[model samples]
Target: MLKDPPITVNVFDEARVNHEMTVELAFVNPVSEILRDCSLTPSGTGLLQWEELTKLPDLMPNNRVCVKLIIVPHKSGERTLLVGFDRASFKDIKTSCIVNVKP
Candidate 1:
């Protein structure tokens, strides 16, 4: 069985309520084989809206891929944002990053 790749999520800058925030997700295929049928999206803490869908191609082995998501925060204060990953060959994955949103 192939092990799933580790997902890294980073919230960039500060965000205000009702404003847009950007979150970056990066991952590397540590296995010797390429990760196929990969999909990335934002999930959980439904306080934010997905502004765009990033079409992620199959990631090469041992290479890193970074994806940025533009999200509009609905509420303020500290919130746990989730980055979701769906793959055809493995189980789904979700990584969280706590972000402070101002009022």
Candidate 2:
């Protein structure tokens, strides 16, 4: 069970441009609602040849899990990767991460 609410997303503070990077996502469902089809998907843009998206198991109330995502920034500077949930119902959740990418 998670001691927080909503969800939490995390990624390395910095990354090298044009290099593959991994972002870790921590999912928390502490409320009384059940989250279905928890997965990560690309934004369809910023196609930096990122690795394939990942899928996660459904989260019952008071459940938590951690997952990772692979990304490759095309350009340097602060890069933001926008992702979505596979279920579509929890699209409004915190589904994005930013990395200070250096060239």
Candidate 3:
């Protein structure tokens, strides 16, 4: 079995106008493993929780990836946040990295 890569996904809270945000990570393999052996760590929480990947799709050989992460806000200010991830995984997709936007 190939071990999954380690990734760090960041969150930007458009409401805070600062860096306060919540970020959780899940993984999808073309082999149909959704969130399998995945984990999430919130900033300053100092804790990591393991979660199951329920809705992840099967990974196909040479297949690309599309991550749908859940944005959980720790504060009560604005409830929405802009989402994005690094392009180190989806190299063949031929798309530009999405710029952070207002939510």
- Enumerate residue pairs that collide in model 1: none
Give the winner by TM-score.
1
Candidate 2: residue pairs that collide: none
In every candidate, how many clashes are there? 0, 0, 9
lDDT of 3 at 21: 37
lDDT of 1: 0.73
64 in model 1: Cα distance from truth in Å?
Answer: 0.9
lDDT of 3 at 87: 34
How do all models score by TM-score? 0.80, 0.66, 0.29
For candidate 3, the C-alpha RMSD (Å) to the true structure equals 10.1
Worst 10 residues of 3 by lDDT: 40-49
Against the reference, the lDDT scores of all candidates come to: 0.73, 0.62, 0.32
- The superposed Cα distance between candidate 3 and the true structure at residue 15, in angstroms, equals 7.7
lDDT of 1 by residue, 1-103 (tens): 4355488988786787877778788877766888877777766454465524455778888888998877777878788877666776656666777788888
State the lDDT of candidate 3 residue by residue for 1-103, as single tens digits.
3344333244433423233334434333334433232222222211112332323344444444445444333333323222222233332221111223333
